[model samples]
Target: MSIEANLEKIERLTSKVWRSYSKEDPLGHLSFNEYDYLKAIQAARVPIRLTDLAKELEVTKPSATNMVKRLERKGLVLRVSCSEDARSKRVMLTEKARAPLESESEIYTIIAQKLKVHLSEQEFDALNTLLTKALR
Candidate 1:
């Protein structure tokens, strides 16, 4: 196979692997965007404003609000008033979200173990470095 074909195959496999995690989502019908927002909020460890979420994702504020609303309905996140500014709302993950987040992580660990069968340790490290560089 040509290098181009190999690269395309990698792209497909990467998307497939990432997309596979959501199928077992316990949050009912969380979309990829919602999962991303939840992941961002969980990673932040600080209360993040809806506007900030929008900015961080390079999306519109209304879009972020909509995503938050959906997550709110699912009981995965809550919109709390900012302590310093009551008028603004910050998003935070609820305890309910912890299970699904942990589950997704466990699934990734399993995926990594499966991937290890096909790549050497050095090759895996190189792949990670190259993928990060490509994103940048």
Candidate 2:
């Protein structure tokens, strides 16, 4: 298979694995986009303003607001009045959000471990560097 085909297959397989894990794990139902938002919110380690969240994700404010609304509906996040700016609201992860994010992290670590076990250290490092550069 071509490199692109292999990459696409890897993505699909990884997502399929995540879907299976989600089925067995009670908190794994979140969509990839939802997970992205949740991870970003969690990374802040404190309530984050919608604007800042949007900037962090490199998305528009409206896009961030819409995702937050969806997350709130899912009971994964909460929008509270910003103490420093009453006009703006900060988004915080709900208690319900924690388990799934942790599960996602575990899934990633498992996949990485599998890859590391298969590849030599130099090969894995090169792949990591290439992947990071490709993203940039």
Candidate 3:
């Protein structure tokens, strides 16, 4: 297959996998925007400033603040005053966020296990290497 054709196939497969996997998340009960915000906080290795999150999410400061407040109410995230900057606040994932994150991870693991039926170990390794390079 041509490179373009392979890329198209990968895109299609990824979409299908995500759609199917997301159905299993109770968090799917939340709006897509809310889920996205929560996922971003969970993915961040460290607490992130509200302004930084706004920039990362391409949202306004008020919008980011509102979303963080909602997440805090849901017990998925906590907003704390930044120690380094008195006026700024940072968002961190709460223990409540772990269940949903772990559930999502399990879904991905299941999808990967199913895909392994079609891909050999070497093919999977090559695909991982290529994807990492392409992402860079």
Candidate 4:
């Protein structure tokens, strides 16, 4: 296949896999962007400030605020007033977000297992390396 065709195929296959995995799960309601924001908040050492989250996600502060609002409405996150800076709010994951976060990791593990079963160890390692490089 041509490069463009191969890229398109990859996108389709990934979407198919994700859809299949998420179809019965509540996490399916979340967009990839929404999941990313939650994942970032979960990875933080403490409840993260909005400005810091924007920096970590490499998005504008306003963009991060908008996404936080969406996640808040979905009951996945909360914006608590920062203790040190009362004017600034910190993003935190709500109890509701726990299952989706765990489910996301499970989806990745399933994908990795499927790939490892189909490819030789070297091919799998090379694919992982190439994908990491390509993403960067």
C-alpha TM-scores of all predictions: 0.75, 0.77, 0.78, 0.75
lDDT of 1: 0.83
Q: Kindly give the number of clashing pairs for every candidate.
A: 0, 0, 0, 0
Q: Tens digit of lDDT per residue, candidate 1, span 44-81?
A: 78889988889988999999999899989988999999
Model 4 Cα lDDT, one tens digit per residue, 1-136 = 7989977876776677788887777666778899889889999957999999999999999999999999999899999999999899999999889766766777787767866897999999999999899998
Q: Is candidate 2 or candidate 3 better by lDDT?
A: 2
What's model 4's TM-score?
A: 0.75
Candidate 1: pairs in clash: none
lDDT of 2 by residue, 56-115 (tens): 999999999999999999899999999898899999988888776666777777667767
lDDT of 3 by residue, 7-78 (tens): 788667767777976776556667889888887787777999999999989999999999999988888888
Where does model 3 exceed 4 Å of error? 1-24
Name the best candidate (by TM-score): 3
Off by over 4 Å in 1: 1-24
